[model samples]
Target chain A: MLNPPEHQVAGHDARLGGLGPLADGSGRFFKPLQSCSRGDNELSFYTSFSSDPRVPPSVRRRFFPSFHGTQLLPASDSSGPKPHLVLQDLTSQFTRPSIIDFKIGSRTWPPSSPSDYIDKCFKKDRETTSLTLGFRVSGLQIHESGDAYYKPSRDEIRSYGHDDVRRIVRRFVSDSGLASAVYGGSDGILAQLLELKSWFEDQTIYHFYSASVMVMYDKEGVENGRSGPAVKLVDFAHVVEGDGVIDHNFLGGLCSLIKFVSEVLTDPDGEGEGRRMKAKKGGTENGK
Target chain B: MLNPPEHQVAGHDARLGGLGPLADGSGRFFKPLQSCSRGDNELSFYTSFSSDPRVPPSVRRRFFPSFHGTQLLPASDSSGPKPHLVLQDLTSQFTRPSIIDFKIGSRTWPPSSPSDYIDKCFKKDRETTSLTLGFRVSGLQIHESGDAYYKPSRDEIRSYGHDDVRRIVRRFVSDSGLASAVYGGSDGILAQLLELKSWFEDQTIYHFYSASVMVMYDKEGVENGRSGPAVKLVDFAHVVEGDGVIDHNFLGGLCSLIKFVSEVLTDPDGEGEGRRMKAKKGGTENGK
Candidate 1:
């Protein structure tokens, strides 16, 4: 039987009364297939991506969730059965997962998309921090310590400007006000993001639009030194073939996100004047 | 376009005038789906095995090929389109791969099978080394250090007795008259088989009958120290749920196979008198 994923911090949530991804208690995540075109596009991306020899094994293993085919399961909305993509549940190994989902790239819609869809995406991108910050926090759940947890609402996440996003990142790494154990070491989140950045810098395989980078770590596992952090690329419904051209838009946005993470690691406490000025300009545009 | 795999050493070969498996030139092996019941059974095994929390990650990653879902492609027999189970091509990384396929277990047919099917399987099992050694070499291709290769015919392989099987194994590890570089190290084939032995020793989730274990290595890669050996469990059409009981049939067969390989590693030159006696007894049964 499938149940709403407890560790899912972003995207559509069935717990809030909608069709969304479900988790089969045993390490499998089932995402309900969207509309025909979008679903086929995403399925095609995963199918071809798995067999693409151009993709390095390390990059594929560390950055993407393993695909396990698709299944027709009863819909969460009781609207008959629906085809769902089966994937490895990233948070299955964690006991108390702290997860953050970042919607990658400044633009969410492609040129080929319908004008109405483009307009809808453009409006959302402008209103959120996506236009000014290059990427925005879609949602996050910070497990500080013990039973205490912090999960910001959808509205709060959507309203986050450059400064708010930075603060949220800092809060995610606080870990009960101690040195965060998930972002500093040689194999930490920063290192992983850098590795992914390196791949994006060279790869010209596919252009991802409205994709997400999900960073997750278990607070208990980190505190106990049992496990480390993981980063995965998700939500590939808008992915398209790059046609032998560099994905400059994705690479640029990835660099921007990497910069934010690097700064958080390097200067955990210092709030520089330069950052404040940039945040102010971004905030002004967001306010407009 | 899918073409016949150049490195395939066993099973039904389309290149040899049969509807068998195809390789995508990249890294995918597409096996044509069989009869509905058998195909569904195999598919079900892979689907559940992938997500079964009971199976350790190490076992899943090392012993089984990563499944990339299934696709409907043109049949090699020109029998219209058919669904194919897509999987990681184990020999994709090798420049000159040497592969061996071993059909595991003594009893190939289940008790629930029809009388004619049982009789056929029982006759074959008794004819081959499966009844004696608990496993039989279904096929093999040994690349002996250069452009030279050794591939025994089906009739020759079927006629192999206990001593012949041992001789064949020794030839595979000879590597053009030198100590084989693919089977002795800490991470080599021996160690990998031992690791799989440990898992089968304890696992009780499923019973695999008539399954095969494929061992492959690139002779050139091993000579250059570029790549090592890989062992993957394949062909799950006859697998059945364990229902909380240990799979004694598979476990026993695995242990027997392990013993044979272990002896080859330890006494590479010494043919013990005890082994001669056992071979004589097994050969007597085969003659009967």
Candidate 2:
């Protein structure tokens, strides 16, 4: 049975209310809903594919719908502020070093299925595939009490497929690759890589603070259940502005910053420092 | 004794005119003197110890001296534009990767020597110490006509010192020790340790930059040197800046960027984005 009282899981499925009063085929809805989170509480937003017979298979949250709500921690608790996210990449042997968290304005979505696109693209077994893209937008909002707020909690992640996103990721990876080469086959290379990784991860998360959709890797579990390496693509998108395109106000330099960062990160050998670097053995290249 | 005029070794030095005026404690003289070089048509900026007697060096020129001239590159040669400086870390095995070259603005102390304090503090081994932080700073001239003009090649190199140079190096190493402790020692600790090393190297380089001192290290020879690792510090505090503190402007941000970059390049598992990441030997620390 599905979870009851949909509101309880609002953090998981945001579209629980479904399409409200569609005006016509033009894709405009007559009834609009608005929700706000408060400073005193933590907010979580989530969505899961539903199996309701009335909904179509192509849509995520078909039966259950997405949810959003604020979480109240015990007032007596001390530890300062609670970290927003805790993502554990099952493949990594090292422990989760820190929480992956960020604040956002508001969230909008399309909620469509895209097969195992994410896993296929980043496949490690030397599989060649076309690059796929995806995106999410979360809106920024001002609370009734005059506080500024961003949507979508830190834990929930969204991916984008736009050429911009692809270009950005590609550049980042390339820069990182050059950096790796410069470090050569030394232990120092590893340290450099770690700091870079932290920077990239942190920067990516920071973009989410505005209205940027994050990059996500599907956790390995389903196919064999026993768990191996394969990751599936999760269906989700975030909207910061009215449409999928982020307004300059919310995500002004985020895309460009992401691009610059990726370019810097991918070139490991210091090749991008106005020069091209040669690749090392076993350094595989993906993406056309 | 110091390789008089006509008998200079081929790769040792050269003399160029139009270096403007030379200033000393006594007075200013406008004379063209012969200079030395390790390579043909190469210029350098370096530091030296003023007090030491065996190499009891006299100030070659003032610290961070300025040269007022223009350099002309063929623009046809594929090597890109030649930098006003061709710096290297004589103490270390590898040359600095990022700073291949740079430009010297007007109002420079034409033929001042690099600071001697830098060399005294940076000891390579117990017995054989580097006399001066040797390097070349070529490509000198005065701009004439429009954007393009004939500039007399006035190339000179000198050395000077600062009391705080050694203290800065020690402080950097100390800070690195603290930073490494924060992230070292765990299952993949070896790998992590390597990462921290890169971070430290970058941080060290960055600190030097902020001090307005251009320090370079042999990337390839750090570990193989006579000391724990091979690195060199060159004092350019005397180089005259037309508008502001040129050394700090070039060194500060660069050092930070280099450190940040070096750390990223050394990442072992590529920032934990793949399937076999779980096979990383150590179990994941989910709670943290």
TM-score of each: 0.48, 0.21
Q: Could you give candidate 2's per-residue lDDT for residues B216-254 as a string of tens digits?
A: 222223224422221222334343311100122222122
Q: For model 1, how does the per-residue alpha-carbon lDDT over A1-288 read when each residue is reduced to its tens digit?
A: 899998898888878767889999889999989885889989889999999999999999999999998999887777779999999999999988888999986567764578799779967977886755557899899986686679988888888876677677777777545334677778888899889866764565788889999988887777787878899999999998754334545554565676567667767774552455556566342222
Measured by lDDT, the strongest candidate is 1
TM-score of chain B of each: 0.91, 0.23
Runs in model 2 deviating more than 4 A are A1-137, A145-288, B1-70, B73-288
- Whose TM-score is greatest here? 1
**Model 1 misplaced stretches (Cα beyond 4 Å):** A177-180, A273-288, B1-288
Q: For candidate 1, what is the DockQ?
A: 0.01
Give each candidate's interface RMSD in Å. 26.9, 20.7
In the order shown, the candidates' Cα RMSDs to the true structure are: 22.6, 24.6
